[model samples]
Target: MINVKVMAVLDLVSILQKREIAFSVEDGTTIRGLLEIMCSQYGPELEKKIYVDKDKELLNLNLYLNGRHIHFLGGLDAVLRNEDTVLLIPYASGG
Candidate 1:
Protein backbone atom coordinates (compact mmCIF):
# COMPACT_ATOMS: atom_id res chain seq x y z
CA MET A 1 0.00 0.00 0.00
CA ILE A 2 1.03 3.57 -0.68
CA ASN A 3 0.30 6.22 1.91
CA VAL A 4 0.07 9.90 1.11
CA LYS A 5 -1.25 13.16 2.44
CA VAL A 6 -3.27 15.73 0.54
CA MET A 7 -3.29 19.43 1.35
CA ALA A 8 -6.14 21.35 -0.21
CA VAL A 9 -6.46 25.12 -0.37
CA LEU A 10 -9.08 27.63 -1.49
CA ASP A 11 -12.52 26.39 -2.38
CA LEU A 12 -11.34 22.85 -2.32
CA VAL A 13 -11.20 23.02 1.47
CA SER A 14 -14.96 23.35 1.56
CA ILE A 15 -15.52 20.83 -1.21
CA LEU A 16 -13.41 18.28 0.58
CA GLN A 17 -14.60 19.42 4.00
CA LYS A 18 -11.09 19.44 5.35
CA ARG A 19 -7.79 21.17 4.73
CA GLU A 20 -5.75 18.03 4.91
CA ILE A 21 -6.54 14.39 4.30
CA ALA A 22 -4.70 11.15 4.75
CA PHE A 23 -5.05 8.90 1.73
CA SER A 24 -3.88 5.48 0.74
CA VAL A 25 -3.49 4.01 -2.70
CA GLU A 26 -2.20 0.81 -4.17
CA ASP A 27 1.46 0.55 -5.02
CA GLY A 28 2.43 2.01 -8.40
CA THR A 29 -0.69 4.11 -8.54
CA THR A 30 -0.44 7.30 -10.53
CA ILE A 31 -1.75 10.77 -9.79
CA ARG A 32 -4.80 10.17 -11.93
CA GLY A 33 -5.45 6.98 -10.07
CA LEU A 34 -5.33 8.83 -6.79
CA LEU A 35 -7.89 11.34 -7.99
CA GLU A 36 -10.13 8.53 -9.17
CA ILE A 37 -10.00 7.02 -5.71
CA MET A 38 -10.85 10.34 -4.15
CA CYS A 39 -13.73 10.77 -6.54
CA SER A 40 -15.11 7.45 -5.50
CA GLN A 41 -14.81 8.38 -1.84
CA TYR A 42 -16.11 11.91 -2.20
CA GLY A 43 -18.57 11.34 -5.03
CA PRO A 44 -19.66 13.67 -7.83
CA GLU A 45 -19.40 16.87 -5.83
CA LEU A 46 -15.69 16.34 -5.67
CA GLU A 47 -15.52 14.84 -9.15
CA LYS A 48 -17.18 17.85 -10.73
CA LYS A 49 -14.59 20.18 -9.24
CA ILE A 50 -11.60 18.33 -10.62
CA TYR A 51 -12.62 16.69 -13.86
CA VAL A 52 -14.00 17.89 -17.14
CA ASP A 53 -15.35 16.17 -20.22
CA LYS A 54 -16.61 13.28 -18.11
CA ASP A 55 -13.27 12.71 -16.39
CA LYS A 56 -11.34 12.71 -19.64
CA GLU A 57 -9.23 15.66 -18.49
CA LEU A 58 -8.40 17.65 -15.39
CA LEU A 59 -10.14 20.89 -14.80
CA ASN A 60 -8.48 24.12 -13.58
CA LEU A 61 -7.06 22.49 -10.47
CA ASN A 62 -3.31 22.62 -10.02
CA LEU A 63 -1.67 19.58 -8.55
CA TYR A 64 1.71 19.69 -6.91
CA LEU A 65 3.72 16.70 -5.85
CA ASN A 66 6.14 17.31 -3.02
CA GLY A 67 6.27 21.03 -3.82
CA ARG A 68 6.82 20.65 -7.58
CA HIS A 69 4.17 20.99 -10.19
CA ILE A 70 2.93 17.67 -11.58
CA HIS A 71 3.07 19.18 -15.06
CA PHE A 72 6.84 18.97 -14.82
CA LEU A 73 6.94 15.66 -12.96
CA GLY A 74 4.80 13.78 -15.55
CA GLY A 75 1.29 15.11 -15.58
CA LEU A 76 -1.34 12.73 -14.24
CA ASP A 77 0.81 9.70 -14.98
CA ALA A 78 3.36 10.55 -12.31
CA VAL A 79 3.76 7.47 -10.17
CA LEU A 80 3.06 7.93 -6.50
CA ARG A 81 5.41 6.82 -3.77
CA ASN A 82 4.90 6.17 -0.09
CA GLU A 83 4.61 9.26 2.10
CA ASP A 84 4.19 11.61 -0.84
CA THR A 85 2.35 14.84 -0.22
CA VAL A 86 -0.01 16.01 -2.94
CA LEU A 87 -1.08 19.60 -2.75
CA LEU A 88 -4.20 20.78 -4.55
CA ILE A 89 -4.59 24.43 -5.38
CA PRO A 90 -7.20 25.74 -7.75
CA TYR A 91 -6.24 28.17 -10.47
CA ALA A 92 -7.24 31.71 -9.76
CA SER A 93 -7.49 34.61 -12.18
CA GLY A 94 -7.81 38.26 -11.29
CA GLY A 95 -7.55 41.40 -13.28
Candidate 2:
Protein backbone atom coordinates (compact mmCIF):
# COMPACT_ATOMS: atom_id res chain seq x y z
CA MET A 1 0.00 0.00 0.00
CA ILE A 2 1.05 3.56 -0.65
CA ASN A 3 0.98 5.98 2.27
CA VAL A 4 0.39 9.65 1.57
CA LYS A 5 0.14 12.73 3.73
CA VAL A 6 -2.46 15.31 2.69
CA MET A 7 -2.38 18.84 3.99
CA ALA A 8 -5.16 21.21 3.03
CA VAL A 9 -5.24 24.98 3.00
CA LEU A 10 -7.86 27.63 3.66
CA ASP A 11 -11.31 26.34 4.67
CA LEU A 12 -10.58 22.83 3.47
CA VAL A 13 -8.12 22.26 6.29
CA SER A 14 -10.32 24.17 8.69
CA ILE A 15 -12.83 21.37 8.73
CA LEU A 16 -10.24 18.65 9.19
CA GLN A 17 -8.12 20.59 11.67
CA LYS A 18 -9.41 18.55 14.57
CA ARG A 19 -7.40 15.52 13.56
CA GLU A 20 -4.29 14.45 11.70
CA ILE A 21 -5.30 13.49 8.17
CA ALA A 22 -3.47 10.96 5.98
CA PHE A 23 -4.22 7.64 4.38
CA SER A 24 -2.94 4.51 2.74
CA VAL A 25 -3.85 3.54 -0.77
CA GLU A 26 -2.86 1.18 -3.53
CA ASP A 27 0.68 1.68 -4.80
CA GLY A 28 -0.34 3.82 -7.78
CA THR A 29 -3.04 6.20 -6.62
CA THR A 30 -2.99 9.51 -8.48
CA ILE A 31 -3.78 13.00 -7.28
CA ARG A 32 -7.28 12.67 -8.68
CA GLY A 33 -7.97 9.72 -6.46
CA LEU A 34 -6.55 11.53 -3.46
CA LEU A 35 -8.90 14.46 -4.12
CA GLU A 36 -11.94 12.23 -4.45
CA ILE A 37 -11.09 10.62 -1.14
CA MET A 38 -10.82 14.04 0.43
CA CYS A 39 -14.25 15.00 -0.82
CA SER A 40 -15.68 11.79 0.55
CA GLN A 41 -14.04 12.26 3.93
CA TYR A 42 -15.24 15.86 4.14
CA GLY A 43 -18.62 14.98 2.57
CA PRO A 44 -20.88 16.95 0.25
CA GLU A 45 -21.56 19.73 2.73
CA LEU A 46 -17.92 20.61 3.29
CA GLU A 47 -16.98 19.74 -0.26
CA LYS A 48 -19.42 22.31 -1.57
CA LYS A 49 -17.68 24.97 0.47
CA ILE A 50 -14.10 24.08 -0.49
CA TYR A 51 -14.38 23.82 -4.24
CA VAL A 52 -16.18 25.30 -7.21
CA ASP A 53 -15.47 22.41 -9.54
CA LYS A 54 -14.90 19.06 -7.87
CA ASP A 55 -14.84 16.99 -11.02
CA LYS A 56 -11.71 16.79 -13.21
CA GLU A 57 -9.93 19.73 -11.67
CA LEU A 58 -9.76 21.88 -8.56
CA LEU A 59 -10.78 25.50 -8.76
CA ASN A 60 -9.34 27.25 -5.74
CA LEU A 61 -6.34 25.09 -5.04
CA ASN A 62 -2.80 24.71 -6.30
CA LEU A 63 -1.57 21.19 -5.54
CA TYR A 64 1.95 20.32 -4.50
CA LEU A 65 3.27 16.87 -3.69
CA ASN A 66 6.50 16.71 -1.74
CA GLY A 67 7.08 20.42 -2.37
CA ARG A 68 6.88 19.95 -6.17
CA HIS A 69 4.03 21.51 -8.09
CA ILE A 70 1.94 18.74 -9.57
CA HIS A 71 0.83 20.84 -12.53
CA PHE A 72 4.40 21.31 -13.66
CA LEU A 73 4.96 17.60 -13.93
CA GLY A 74 1.79 15.83 -15.04
CA GLY A 75 -1.12 17.50 -13.31
CA LEU A 76 -3.56 15.07 -11.68
CA ASP A 77 -1.75 12.13 -13.18
CA ALA A 78 1.40 12.91 -11.22
CA VAL A 79 2.82 9.83 -9.59
CA LEU A 80 3.27 9.88 -5.85
CA ARG A 81 5.26 7.76 -3.44
CA ASN A 82 4.94 6.85 0.20
CA GLU A 83 5.80 9.59 2.74
CA ASP A 84 4.92 12.33 0.23
CA THR A 85 3.20 15.35 1.71
CA VAL A 86 0.47 16.69 -0.53
CA LEU A 87 -0.27 20.32 0.09
CA LEU A 88 -3.46 22.00 -1.02
CA ILE A 89 -2.59 25.64 -1.41
CA PRO A 90 -5.43 28.01 -2.16
CA TYR A 91 -5.13 30.71 -4.78
CA ALA A 92 -4.87 34.31 -3.69
CA SER A 93 -4.58 37.45 -5.78
CA GLY A 94 -4.12 41.01 -4.53
CA GLY A 95 -3.19 44.23 -6.21
Candidate 3:
Protein backbone atom coordinates (compact mmCIF):
# COMPACT_ATOMS: atom_id res chain seq x y z
CA MET A 1 0.00 0.00 0.00
CA ILE A 2 0.98 3.62 -0.60
CA ASN A 3 0.63 6.23 2.09
CA VAL A 4 -0.62 9.63 0.98
CA LYS A 5 -1.21 12.85 2.85
CA VAL A 6 -4.30 14.87 1.97
CA MET A 7 -4.61 18.55 2.95
CA ALA A 8 -7.94 20.31 2.64
CA VAL A 9 -8.38 24.06 2.55
CA LEU A 10 -11.21 26.58 2.95
CA ASP A 11 -14.64 25.02 3.32
CA LEU A 12 -13.30 21.53 2.98
CA VAL A 13 -12.23 21.55 6.63
CA SER A 14 -15.88 21.23 7.65
CA ILE A 15 -16.23 17.96 5.79
CA LEU A 16 -12.79 16.62 6.58
CA GLN A 17 -12.94 17.80 10.21
CA LYS A 18 -9.18 18.15 10.22
CA ARG A 19 -6.93 20.09 7.92
CA GLU A 20 -5.01 17.04 6.87
CA ILE A 21 -5.38 13.29 6.83
CA ALA A 22 -3.21 10.31 6.07
CA PHE A 23 -4.63 7.72 3.74
CA SER A 24 -3.44 4.28 2.81
CA VAL A 25 -4.38 3.12 -0.64
CA GLU A 26 -3.49 0.03 -2.60
CA ASP A 27 -0.35 0.28 -4.61
CA GLY A 28 -0.78 1.80 -8.08
CA THR A 29 -3.97 3.64 -7.18
CA THR A 30 -4.49 6.78 -9.21
CA ILE A 31 -5.43 10.17 -7.79
CA ARG A 32 -9.00 9.67 -8.91
CA GLY A 33 -9.29 6.38 -7.10
CA LEU A 34 -7.90 7.87 -3.91
CA LEU A 35 -10.46 10.66 -4.12
CA GLU A 36 -13.27 8.16 -4.60
CA ILE A 37 -12.22 6.37 -1.47
CA MET A 38 -12.14 9.66 0.45
CA CYS A 39 -15.59 10.61 -0.78
CA SER A 40 -16.96 7.31 0.37
CA GLN A 41 -15.52 7.87 3.81
CA TYR A 42 -16.68 11.46 4.07
CA GLY A 43 -20.10 10.86 2.46
CA PRO A 44 -22.34 12.79 0.06
CA GLU A 45 -21.51 16.31 1.22
CA LEU A 46 -17.89 15.85 0.28
CA GLU A 47 -18.81 14.01 -2.89
CA LYS A 48 -20.71 17.04 -4.19
CA LYS A 49 -17.77 19.37 -3.48
CA ILE A 50 -15.17 17.32 -5.25
CA TYR A 51 -16.97 15.59 -8.10
CA VAL A 52 -18.97 17.39 -10.75
CA ASP A 53 -20.86 14.37 -12.07
CA LYS A 54 -21.60 10.71 -11.43
CA ASP A 55 -18.50 9.88 -13.46
CA LYS A 56 -16.37 11.49 -10.72
CA GLU A 57 -15.02 14.30 -12.79
CA LEU A 58 -13.20 16.80 -10.55
CA LEU A 59 -14.84 20.12 -9.91
CA ASN A 60 -13.12 23.51 -10.28
CA LEU A 61 -11.13 23.05 -7.08
CA ASN A 62 -7.39 23.25 -7.47
CA LEU A 63 -5.62 20.03 -6.66
CA TYR A 64 -1.92 19.83 -6.00
CA LEU A 65 0.23 16.75 -5.77
CA ASN A 66 3.34 17.29 -3.75
CA GLY A 67 3.00 21.03 -4.24
CA ARG A 68 2.65 20.65 -8.01
CA HIS A 69 -0.64 21.16 -9.76
CA ILE A 70 -2.30 17.94 -10.92
CA HIS A 71 -3.15 19.48 -14.26
CA PHE A 72 0.53 19.53 -15.07
CA LEU A 73 1.00 15.90 -14.11
CA GLY A 74 -2.09 14.30 -15.75
CA GLY A 75 -5.22 15.41 -14.00
CA LEU A 76 -6.97 12.62 -12.07
CA ASP A 77 -4.96 9.90 -13.79
CA ALA A 78 -1.82 10.98 -11.96
CA VAL A 79 -0.34 7.97 -10.20
CA LEU A 80 0.56 8.31 -6.55
CA ARG A 81 3.58 7.02 -4.69
CA ASN A 82 4.42 6.38 -1.06
CA GLU A 83 4.47 9.53 1.07
CA ASP A 84 3.00 11.72 -1.66
CA THR A 85 1.05 14.77 -0.56
CA VAL A 86 -2.24 15.95 -2.08
CA LEU A 87 -3.62 19.39 -1.33
CA LEU A 88 -7.12 20.58 -2.22
CA ILE A 89 -7.58 24.33 -2.60
CA PRO A 90 -11.06 25.45 -3.48
CA TYR A 91 -11.65 28.39 -5.77
CA ALA A 92 -12.59 31.67 -4.16
CA SER A 93 -14.69 34.12 -6.10
CA GLY A 94 -16.09 37.47 -5.02
CA GLY A 95 -14.94 40.96 -4.41
**Highest TM-score, which number?**
3
**Which scores higher on TM-score, 2 or 3?**
3
Candidate 1 vs candidate 3: the lDDT winner is 3
TM-score of each: 0.91, 0.79, 0.92
User: Candidate 3 residues 1-95, lDDT tens each?
Assistant: 98999999999998899999999999999999998899889999888888777777757588999999999999999999999999998888788
Q: lDDT winner among the candidates?
A: 3
Which stretches of candidate 3 lie above 4 Å from their native place?
Answer: 93-95
Clashing pairs in 1: none
Candidate 2 Cα outliers beyond 4 Å, as residue runs: 18-20, 49-51, 93-95
> Model 2: per-residue lDDT, tens digit, 1-95?
98888877666667777334778978888887777787788787556654676564555567788888987869888877898888877776687
- Residues 1-95 of candidate 1 have per-residue lDDT tens digits of 98999999989999899999999789999999999899899888888878765954756688999999999999999999999999988887788
lDDT of each: 0.89, 0.75, 0.91
How do these models rank on TM-score, best leading? 3, 1, 2
Better model by TM-score: candidate 1 vs candidate 2: 1
Which residue pairs come into collision in candidate 3? Answer: none
Clashes found in each candidate (C-alpha, N, C closer than 3 A): 0, 0, 0
